[model samples]
Target: MALSSTQTDHLRRVDAIGDPPARPTLVPAERYHSPAFAQLEVERMWPRVWQVACTVDHVAEPGDYFEYRCGPYSVLIVHGDDGVLRAFQNACRHRGNALCTGAGSSLRELKCGYHGWTWDLAGALKRIPNRKGFGTVHMSEFPLAPVQVDTWERLVFVNLDTSAMPLADYLEAVPTDIAWCGLGDFRCYATMTIAVDANWKTIADGYSETYHVQTLHPELHRCMDDVYAPQMIWGHTGKSESLYGVPSPRLSGALSDEEVWDAYVYTQGPLMGVAEGTPFPRDQQGAGQSVADVIAAQIKQFAAGRGVDIDWATTDQVMRLHQYNVFPNMTFLASADHLTVMTSLPGPDPDRGELVMTLMTRMPAQAPRTRPADVHMSAADAHPGVVMSQDIAVLTGLQRGMHQPGFTHLVLSSEERRIINMHRNLERYLDLPEAERISEAAAGG
Candidate 1:
């Protein structure tokens, strides 16, 4: 396929992470504003893509289940009595009624309350509840229809199009890239999910680049580089990533001592909540110590207290500083001690969408953790300001203005090459006919 102007810039970007090609095209705003366009995504894009449906912990035990809700399609994942994990169309095989209502466990069969049809966790039909009432029936033909389900490092993913590429093939370069982070052991530390009034892609795009950080999150500059240049914004195959930490290359010289500690105390200190959010001990050497030297000492001492050995010098980049956009709607940011997952899913309204944020960490092997109940945050609810509120305000504002006469498209930078690559990859899915997509996926794309 011939590259679009935007994609050609993306090809140029692949040569180096820090520089944006001189002339990336302006992205059309209609992609974010048009309901018809959103509907095309609903029909041609989302269904054909593989997405993280839920975490493995959501359905960890036999009979446990979680609803992978996207738009009006409610998918149910269950750890069945057969000791296997499975995904199925949440609708009953009979009369098209929903089979699962919400998430719960300890079930041997998924029984439809409406008409009493039931299926096993492996999606096998088990009962029709007085089969004579339906007269002669072919029970095999009435079993729950299955969705393609697979896992990678404990993330459960589902695809509605059975003909799309295998999950591993779809993941492309992501797995090996994140291997050093040891993500599998990072338990769910905290999770927050909310429905919102913005397009899912808009929210995904918000996290795709660091260009807006210096303007939107200046406080973070104290500890991490928000500068777009000199930041390694590498992309390969179908995935992309960028890192934080390492003082901004734009800084003329090494950070002053005060700059190091001030940045540390405000950012990493507060984040670690060292001594319950008070200033860290300052016990480490205070005079003439480089940032790396100070950080290396602190990590060694901290890990010593926790009875673990971490190669901080070698794996320092993993020290709470890397992130990746997992195509479609999932973004994962990992620190040495934790991982944050952000997801954007189509909303009930074409112009609006849903957002989910989950914090995964291993700060303490036995930290007290709880997954919070899903809540609906109003558009006006910018309670915990800064990052969340600023992003919400801007995206909602963009949503409102995108359709206006003055605004026609997005003027993106090389910093947002990830977005360009993402949209083009989406086009691949959108262009294929549904039957062909399924066939291609099943044949191992």
Candidate 2:
């Protein structure tokens, strides 16, 4: 689809934001605390973009369903008896009462609390409590409004606009890139959601850089590498992949040949050596050599090769933390053995929002291969109530601080530029005149 003249102008405006400067800073007050900006975002951005709902794991069986909120809008995902997953506005057509309450479940019909109006799983109005007073009422035209719903891998997604472009087009190359990370096979071992005092962007920005690992998480620093670099893949739907290469142990400290060999054998066993079929040496690191020492040596070698100076002793790499901010409102984190998906929903109060995190994995019975108990991984935790507490503290604080007169803009590093890019994309969507920015992109746009 050819871009409308208005959309073309919008794109030009985005390009004018410039290739992004070296030190782009955002005004904390405008973005974090301004109620005006939040309302504008809800109007311009929330409805037009694709947002994650949940995963197939949560509603795998027919009649299974889940409910999600986007701004003031409530949505229900229903798996009909015919095995099709559909989304509907959680409201009745008669008096605009909420239709389905709580999370969705197997049911012959959904009855409203305010009035006895009922809808079938397919969203068709099946009954009205009193037919006598509504002699001329047309139920056919009053069926629930439908929303766009689709799936990628096993995750469910919904868009408020019924005419929006197909989900596949919006996703672009992201699916293939995630496959490269072996995400399709990853099982959810644990999941967490914490309320933050800062904006949703703040939560995302915090995870984008490893600059905080050394200071914020001293214990994790001791076990991981210090150099955290992210590679950006740009498009309508983009991705940023961060790589943390494990350092070899021999370089960290002076070690006897026996101890060095043993250290290499033990630490590398699960990661590099096992795939190579190397035997585990008896004395992996010398009696005097610590895991930290081996890691330091590995880091030095890598930095030397890249002409960069960073410490491995103070870095963390085993968890291979990855945050995939899928455009609009969904972000996924992939650890070495688990995956967590976080979805942001707009709130009635612009300052407050709802976030849902879902963890998924293959059932043990469904797996063809069997591993020993020591090697077996556990399921991911989906309840993020605790982790969210820590996030809420910082986010709320930041949001409040944005109200200060001294706060103006945020300075960002080249490494942290992705956050700015995200904001730019958001601006592009939100700035479009109400009519020009349609719900779905045309086929070829």
Candidate 3:
């Protein structure tokens, strides 16, 4: 499942490393905590951009539905009885009541609880309570307001702008770049909605760069190559690739091979079904095999136990994590046998947001799909994983720091270009005036 040499060459052409800007990018701090700015985003940005709503597993069978909410917008994604997937504005036409609340299966129709206004799974208006009250009501004229819905691999995305570009087009070269990994074979088994006290961008920026790996994620730093992890930017989407199962060059040869293995086991043991304190398999190390090769072998063996065949995946394919960012609020980190998609949604205020992680596991091609278990928890109670938990724990202080009177703007480096690219796309969507747009910081003497 590894990329061919030709494909790797193509990837090199898209790599954005060694392309640093003339100076640092300066983004206003108010964009993180200003209600006015958040309102502008809600009005102009959130509706038009493509966002990951749920996985196809959440709505595989007919009558299944998942309600996706962001800021003031709510979208109802449904699998119709006609075997087609569709989305609506999640509001009843009559009294503007929500047609659905949470995720569930076996939904015959969407009926407003407050009023009896009903619609079929296809979003066609079906009936209304006491129809005589409104004499001029027309069924065809009042179908549930449609929203655009599409799929790439197993992830479902929605856009309120029906005229928006197709999902494949919006994704640019990302789908093709990652096509060798067999992404569709991984099925989401669970999702955790962790409530955090930070702006959605605050949560998203955490995953957009590797600059914090050494400081904020000491354990992850011991295992991943923070440096030499190249990035790519293609319009609304971007990518970052970090090779795991190796000591970071930052450590400067201080970590032994066994130490690297231990770090990997501590930070991501579940991927290979290894326990936290498990020692490296010194005996299983082949004549010329490296720690990465040993780890890849273990992962393949683990997948085999679940009837998922990843023997075709090379060490590079399994150890190099392909982290992708879809502008605004979504990032999915994937390897040959591992996948985790995360999205940050605006909360009640600019200083609050929800980090939703859709966890996936590789399964046999013939394996049956099931609805993912969706659970909500506060940042304090969310221990999804060692690395991710650390990411969530820092949001509280980061949000508060953004409000400091002296903290005018966030200075960025070329390493954090993904975050800068997000702001670039965001400005285009919000149509911010020149004074409000992100700019280059003054050059240092």
Candidate 4:
């Protein structure tokens, strides 16, 4: 099932031209409800792509390890004793049982709890618990399987496909774009994954565009460009994003553009993270500058206090904390001096999933990095951040509403090009032939 029957037919029809069906709007509801579609994604899409497994800080020391699970696949990302990062199938060599159920640290070697079969950090079998008990076991051929892995801007990613393209090529300009915002310098501060009663795409799509901000996250207009920027959108490593810090031209209700600008410049404090008591320069417009310019001046002052220098005048404030949606599941929200990294994994069914949200920023070099927080989910009032809570709060209802017979297709907006981009990319992976998927991924197709 595709976003719509037309979405499905159109894809098959125009695919000969090397372009995807233009799913600008009216996506089929089956995209979120079809079990076959979900299975296709799991079998065809998830395995052959580059996915963020964890942050460098998560496995900062040799022996520190974490498990990355997607569907039936489990990968153990280890900081090898060689002082390099490596990923391996988490199953034991003997009897193919999981070597480790969860994350742990300071393990000199991987010892299977099932039978105590052991392997070294180099993924070489070191011992079998019962030496004489395994006459048929071939130790030479039984080492943990390795997966393709790499790092960028402290993010560790893994690809199940051996032939997949190098991480740098697939990622293209994402790092460069983040570096431009100075977010490449930020470090992970706090991270958490929340289970949501919606499809992973539903949650990811919510963050990709600002089409719903005025109706969904009205408060965000205080400092966000709810409208998508066309020119810069394509420059984001071939991804789509919604910029922050600049007011949305599509104001909620009937507010004037001047009022939006006034709110953008004048609204201070936690709402926009302005210095606690920073006052607005003027009530109307600040010194005859555009919204982005006015925001830069105020933020530059605020950032100066924190010892970070930004190109105040020219820095596109919209990207100060923009949300960049990488294909598959990762969405990196690079804000001024920090980022909110988000990714998702499917649940028992694809319609439900776990969404991990990490609030990351630079801690002074001397500060110890904090571990990720436990899983949590709550309504707008209870979730830590009201903005985020609101997004999560509507998911359950949204998921159910998506299945309503009357709501058979999605009505997207111009600002929602990101969702379209993601879907098309997803279809590319799904439609790929099994034999070619791995090879094409390796080629960064």
Candidate 5:
């Protein structure tokens, strides 16, 4: 017999509470300075989560390999002789030295630099410098430790737990959402790495909102439509984000003289357009109109040739940036034309963190694509790694400020609540009894 409507509603409500809709602010100290908390997080929260390591393009050939970190653990991604992608603990069994220090082409065996103990791509022990030194020793028992590895949409991920849930199960709605954004068809364009003196959460918190756009990036802010607000997505393993809409000045037909001036200023400012002479002044009449009005004007003018009345400023097309924070340490941001993945891992110092950004594009078949010589900046300059460096500075400063004797709690904006929800999920996962925490599926139907 089928269940009644009331029963369905009850089940839905129960699920919502299990993954609560609202949560309290995460105390600054809990995240920024606590070693005990960080360790517990690694053991409980990170091990069960899905983390992005690298792209399939990095190791496309049979022998290609890449190395990445899952929280504090270093993992090696290898394409074995059997033509399978595998992930293993990068540490060697003999003297605890890292097996692979960097990324490169395929290797038949990964040999330890410290002691020369060797293991194949499949992580099976193949060679020992002196087998007879240890009498009656079993080589099979010394194979490298394996980690749970999987791929989706050509991205690689590793989980420390041997029996962790499948990547799809943990990802929940992210795959379908990414498909909606047309990310599968998009390729990487550039990549950069920034080492920062702050907690990983600090870097993530900065990306979660558009509130900083107006002040933090005054020059770039002119091109952005500020009227539309951001929309948040709830109820998944971690924090998932989607923008409802953004202002598009080019689509809006109401651009005033002042709006045009702002656009010219933005275009001329070190990045986009570069033409000589002072920019035109804002039209006095256009100065009073909303930013949306000016954007509408520009969009109409630009679209008239294409035969469309669409106002990109008021339209949803402007809301193209989609970001997914895949619990604990990775954030994936995508737009119609570009994609960037940021991985945040804990550093040796409690007050510092390391971030690696991998930017990619569709692999072209023959002719190599190169940045235009006339362009003032490289791809990295276009999408300045300095922006992340700025964030790192702020996060580290915030980390230090949290320890002040006068500081006690935090005041959070509605938009900043996502960080709070992230902490709550961490707590829920960490607090679960060992048996109950095994797998979401095991919690029962």
Candidate 6:
């Protein structure tokens, strides 16, 4: 397959990761189900690395608050009356009761439900039920334990380690890589948290590569050129770009333009307001325009209807999906008029995890902000999209497969380097012994 002009430029601009290993990469299967390893992640990785807690929309107005939980750790994010965003350890200073449970607006103060201890929106201890009962209890002495909080584009992120690097630095080159997409213009309208019976890494690995599209996502394969998809790595962050609205080059036969259109509609017609079984508008194709060009035009029209101007975007910009993966368990894919952010959080045990999806749409500048509708569902009830549903359906089996006695390690190809990069980052944080680190097997061994 030949690389497009934009793809050529993308390859030339960034410092690519090292070439594919000479043989299959091996990762231990026990990491997926080991209780001790999970504990290590909870202590070392979750507390130290920056993670997307919620979207700015979730806490857009003063007094709005959202609770983010990973494993047993909970962080409460609040929009203060002073026009500042703040996060705390979500524990009351007195008796260690949770100050808040879920998310809502119009919060006057952080009041503990159990003992009636309270704090101001800025996290300063303001009131105590009985001042005389406690000896020398200074309000200033016991403010809420602070957590580092910041925003990138419209997504809010929190880090328990106050000394961790700024979110911008932690993201490496990802921010500058997709600045052309104007991510700030996209407004999150909803989020879905689906409970899955799979390890968090199992859920995350599904998004880290395109290697499964040919077999697992046939409809997606017909609309995306997975073979020519290129990737780049930058320390804790990396990205993959795949052109859509075309048939996969791996397909044996040439598909007609209408066939390609149907595949795209079946996979992601909602993006352009197209209904299922909608036929391609043959008349819509102008001279020298390909199927991708027509799809890009339709997307532009959809954006204009919402008062969002994407006229400056070219076909390549709108048709290519840029996927960025943040270490541990965060991945977001964006195009000129689309954005979806996903994250996986560890559940009660190593065999369980939750996949949270943040759905966004491009909106006109100065669009009124509203709190996003957040919903939680079991895996059986989740139907985020055709492609996403497919991804979710395989998690349980993939997780259970790792526990088989004969399944010792996962053999990975270079196409899955993003997943490999995640393990590399995990090793740095967990300080795994040399014996547990990943290695490449010698060819034909």
TM-score, every prediction:
0.83, 0.70, 0.95, 0.80, 0.71, 0.96
Stretches off by above 4 angstroms in model 4 are 1-24, 231-246, 251-320, 364-382, 432-445
Tens digits of lDDT, candidate 1, 1-445: 1222322232333322455454545666777877777777888877777788777667777888888878778788888777788888889887888887767778878888898888877887888887887889887887787888898876788988888889888777778877877777666544566666788988888877767766765555554545422223233233333333334434525555456455555555533334423433456655653454455556556655655445543424433355677678888876565567888988877678877776555544454434434444665753433456677777777677877888966766666667776666665656744432211111222
Which 10-residue span in candidate 5 carries the lowest summed lDDT? 371-380
Q: Taking the tens digit of each residue's C-alpha lDDT, what string does model 5 give over 1-445?
A: 1322322232233111123234333344545667876787777877776678777666666777777765568888898878899988889998899988657775878999987998888888888888899887787999889988898776778887888888887777778766744445434444455666677776666765555655665433455533243435454434323321122322334444455446534432222122334444236225344332333344344444434333323322322345776666667776433367777767665566766676643332342433211112222233443344445546656778877777755545455545655655666868945433212111223
State the lDDT of candidate 6 residue by residue for 349-374, as single tens digits.
Answer: 99999999999988888889977999
lDDT of 4 by residue, 1-445 (tens): 0122322222232111123334435566777878888899888888899998888877888998989888788999998899988899888876788877667789799888887888889899888877887667777788889999898877889999989989888887777765656554667755676877889888888877665767877766755654443313442234444444445545433554445445544433442355433454456344445444455555665555666555443445433445666778888766565567888778788668878876676444565666554455533234556577778888899899988889867766545667766766776878945432211112222
lDDT of 2 by residue, 53-116 (tens): 7666556667777776666768888888889998998888889988765454566677788878
In candidate 1 the C-alpha lDDT for residue 119 amounts to 80
As for lDDT, the candidate ahead, 1 or 3, is 3
What C-alpha RMSD separates each model from the true structure? 8.4, 13.0, 3.2, 9.3, 10.5, 2.4
Q: On lDDT, who's better, 1 or 6?
A: 6
Ranking by TM-score: 6, 3, 1, 4, 5, 2
Model 3 over residues 261-328: C-alpha lDDT tens digits? 99999999999999999998999987767688889999999999999888898888999999999998
In candidate 3, position 129 carries an lDDT of 85
Cα-based lDDT at residue 249, candidate 6: 68
